[model samples]
Target: DSFNAFMSLNERAARSALLDIQKALGPFRNERVLAATAVTDMAISSLQRRSVTIYLAPNITDMTVLRPLLTLFVQQVMDLLTREHNPDALPVYFLLDEFRQLKKMDEILNKLPYVAGYNIKMAFVVQDLKCIDEIYGETARHSLLGNCGLQLILGANDQVTAEYASRALGKRTIRYQSETRTLELFGRARRTRVEQIRERDLMMPQEVRQMREDKAILLVEGQRPILASKLRYHAIEPFKTAALASRQNTVPVPDVEMARALPVPATLPDYAVDGPDPRPGRIELDRHEVIDDAAFEASSAENVDAAVSSKERLVVTARKLKSVIAACLSAADMPMNQRISIQDVLAKTIPDPEEVGLD
Candidate 1:
């Protein structure tokens, strides 16, 4: 009846046909939709462990599921951090690979700079600087990367990214000596030498684009940039064993107690469209096993030396930030408008150092 409504009532029916229950429910009858809507044993607290928990990207066919999962995860994490103080609420790290592919990614990143106090840390992987700017807008890109404690560039072939890296890396003072010579017709040649100092890019855009695949560039906040070899996990013992061996095979595994190892999410069974819908949480949520925490616990890393460096880091950060602001003020394309003010952004986001005790 719903499908033929356009034919039955022509112009009148076209506007309201899709609003009917029968037409709306048709989309939910698909197996993929059913699986997404069905109940599952998901506990936000269960994911708050001291070890790694990897979330693999969803298949292309199941892409719609990613948005809810990500949003739910964020909401639950915020609630867990504020609403209830669980004893086991340790630091939670979100390692977001293919970061731009996720839906509402800006929501996650917008909250990043302030969430450190809640023990929330995130690492986002991006391929092209222009793409991020295009996808999330230039201001957001600036905000997200500017506050990062570390910026690691594995590879950059695009000119936009190379230029961005070249700028972000700052400059170095280079000194060189120049020689001038003139030949005399009657006798010997006379020569003069002069020395001068000038500033140049530490890494030029061309050099950044030509960087080797095995190497990486790291820009640590307040410290000098580092060019180092990338870690080869495949060549490492436990990594190689885990990748090639079966689930039951534990060869070459680390000697640490099994309880201390990272917790892995269990695979959920695919639900059929024809089957009755089951309430979510019918299955048990995954949790960490009891372990001896003191055996591997390291002493508090925050000491007087780190406290002294905190001021220096903030100073370096503020200098770079001023440069960024200056560039914005000069650039015609910095995207300032009546509704949006960078001044307000900086004022709100740049928290009081005294409040955080970093001062």
Candidate 2:
């Protein structure tokens, strides 16, 4: 039974490799489960039988593609794990590196509690908290990171992320103050000592300097970096070597277009132009068509009288039909078609109606 399934044509080979590892492990014992990361091409169904699967999808700049794929992958993994139970099975450690490359990973992380019952542990490696916050927002970052048992942060350049990391690691405060002491002579010959209040703490200058220079910091179980190492001196060398090697002999391949041509229709149809002209010629109004002061005055007087008479009639009509409008709106027994007709009637009642133009 395969533990991990990858769902891509490009990742079929990698998926096979993961299945090989599962087969070699032979029923899951306490073995260091290290396999090359699975790409997105591998489908979830391929690894349905496997106890654990780690997906290593590429960093996609487009959220449209990345989000749905990751969401589907996480949901499928959770569903598969939840469906099966093996009390004697070995715990699955799911490692997701460059996790921020996936869109909305925080949503997937939020639901990880469901798989906790199946003894599935998840480790997400991201460049910084800012990356997570950018993809998942601040609220999600808090919830996702809070859920994790251990958080390992490497070199972080941003102050906001550093402050978050610092808070997570916890802090200790030390206070110091300077004061002047003086002796006061109250009476002619009596002198008493007068002392000013001061506070201080013991903090080594070298320790502060080291903290500033340290690039790597590990926070485990909400504990400070009791065992932190500088990446330059203590970290593994193979990773840097592999990254450099992978960059070499990487020549860009030119895109090749397929030779096949698409089929075309034999006959095309034409239609008459309608509505407003896209490019209308400018025209000047004739002198007779233009309005003069006498014509304007006569038109204004006629329009005003007609409008006043029409408004009075409209008010009376509105008063009479107010009950009908109210009845239509409140008609619970009205069918959908009738309600639509009533809505159309009300919509058509707007003043200065425009043509229902089509593109």
> Ten residues in a row with the worst lDDT in model 2?
30-39
lDDT tens string, model 2, 1-359? 23334433247787777787676454223221111122234555434345545644544553443454455557667676566766654666667776765556444665676667767677888877788888878887888877887766555566666667655555455444555555457634433454555432222222322454555556677454543666652245877777677679588989864233433432212111333322222222344687667776676676666556666766765665676667666985888665657555565443222221111
lDDT of 2 at 1: 22
- Each prediction's TM-score versus the true structure: 0.56, 0.42
* lDDT at 13, model 1: 65
Misplaced by over 4 Å in model 1 are 1-29, 49-56, 64-88, 236-359
- Which pairs clash inside model 1? 39-280, 40-280
RMSD of 1: 34.9
- Output the lDDT of residue 226, model 1: 94
Every candidate's lDDT: 0.68, 0.57
Q: Looking at candidate 1, what is the lDDT of residue 199? A: 98
